[model samples]
Target: MMTRLVTDRLMMRRAQSTDLEGFHAVVSDFEVVRMTSSWPWPADRAYTKTRCVPINAAHGMAGPVLCKGEIVGIMGALSMYDDGPELGYMFARAHWGQGFATEMARALLDHVWAQYDWDVIKASAYDDNPASVRVLDKLGFHEVEPTIGTCKARGGDFPLRCFQLPRPPLTRV
Candidate 1:
């Protein structure tokens, strides 16, 4: 089943073929792509299109972050590490400085924790991207370590800050 999450100002659902154009637009921006690890620098439409295809939820959740029916960003919690699913997100440069990243991430993390059986979710940010670091921090992700990570866009290894958020304690009625 496709996962859909709704927040006060954003709605995140499975990616559709129709979203390819918007997805490409966001990834095509060098300022946005440089902060991510997977997307290459010279954004390719073909690769961006491939990303629009939805994957099985058992692997993780991913989709477009829509605001009033327009794609503004992308968010995901993919099993990129052996430890657990990793949280990742990117927003259009126009949407930067807004609270969309934190809002979407909080909703995604909440949904993942409640719907999935994972004990913890992992996340990381390039040391240079203080914006992302702040987002992860605001969401209560604890810093675990500092390591070198490769940025496909930057085309080299850079200082990476790793983080993890454990599932919140259950509350009884």
Candidate 2:
């Protein structure tokens, strides 16, 4: 079944076929795609459509972040590394500066921790993107290391800072 997460101001759920136009709008922006490691530059609608497939699997979950029924961003965690699932998110340039990233991420992480047995969740930010770094920090992710990451949009490598949030201690009810 597709997973859905609701926060005070946003609704996140598995991407649906209808979210194409909205998802494209967010992924098409050069400024937004440049910071993403996988999205290609000169955005392709076809590629973006493929990402709209509802994903809820053993490895990860992903979907669109909606506000008042409109898609504003995309967020998810994927098992891209051996240590754990890597958290990733992207928002339209217009949506930056709001606390949506942090809010949505916090909810998703909560769900993941409660539903899964993973011990650590990894994340990364381009060294130059302090905004994303701040989001990760706000989510309580600690810096793990620095490494070079390739951005398909930039078509080159850039300095990336890795981070991880270990599973919170279980509390007896």
Candidate 3:
């Protein structure tokens, strides 16, 4: 995670307090935050300033997703369960459906494969979020299970679809 991950249209670096405004914009929207695992919906600038940065930083995986040097969203991984690292990402509503999420996830996966010896990465999405499931599917993640979980942002339990991607074989020397 030392190097910034990049794609043709996005740049990802560790999230910092300086990105408060952009972070606020993305998480404040109900549509955007509803599907998220941790963010509390109806987020305001005050909450973003007070809470978001520290929470993201603590995860050590949350990074600002930038476009042309401007923050557009956040992407990263965290181990919520004892099994392994769980891949997660969130883009501003304005940037949705342009392949940015898939791009970011792929870049993250590449980085993980190259720099870490982990066997697999896990991810989960609300079963209702077809777009997220599509992104995971496109990256070769297969469904592992289904469970119910609470989304702090939405303040209710929802059906969660879990998926995993095993590390691809490394090249021979």
Candidate 4:
């Protein structure tokens, strides 16, 4: 089944090869990938091609985020992680600060929680990425701790902060 999730102005679905050029355009921007943990700087079309392989597979539920028919970014969860369900999102620089990430993330979280029996969702942000932190905070995620994380693209360790949003208690039938 093709996984799809929608929000007010965003549509997230299985990423396709068609997304490579658009995806590369965003990830290649230095300012966009600077704070991202794993994205390589100068992200070429070849790199985007390689990355789309797994996203198209059935592994992580990862997909592209679209706005008005254009791929703006990617967002998804690992389905399940050691700590819990881990959610992540990335947006093109041009779309930053428009609440698209927040809107898309909220929609995805709602879908996952409703369809599964998960207790908490986890996420992380580089210390310098206040935008991401704000999105998670507005989603009701509470800060957990600060730790070191390697940004392969930057070839260095940066301070990363973790956050978690616990599922609200269920009501009796």
Among all windows of 10 consecutive residues in model 4, the one with the lowest summed lDDT is 52-61
The backbone clash count of each candidate, in order, is 0, 0, 0, 0
Clash pairs of candidate 1? none
State every prediction's TM-score relative to the real structure.
Answer: 0.95, 0.94, 0.87, 0.88
Model 2: lDDT of residue 79: 72
lDDT tens digits by residue: candidate 1, 37-147 = 889879999989899888677777899999999899999988755767899999999999989999999888888877777878889999999999999999999999799
Residue-wise C-alpha lDDT for candidate 2, range 20-117, written one tens digit per residue: 99999998899999999989989899899898887756767789999998899999976745666889999988889999999999999888887777
Identify the runs in model 1 with alpha carbons over 4 angstroms from their true place.
171-173
TM-score of 3: 0.87
lDDT tens digits by residue: candidate 3, 67-97 = 9987787877765457778888878888889
Better structure of 1 and 4 per lDDT: 1
Q: Which portions of model 3 show Cα errors greater than 4 Å? A: 44-60, 171-173
Model 4 residue pairs with clashes: none
The models' CA-based lDDT, in order, is: 0.90, 0.89, 0.79, 0.80
TM-score of 1: 0.95
Best-first order by lDDT: 1, 2, 4, 3
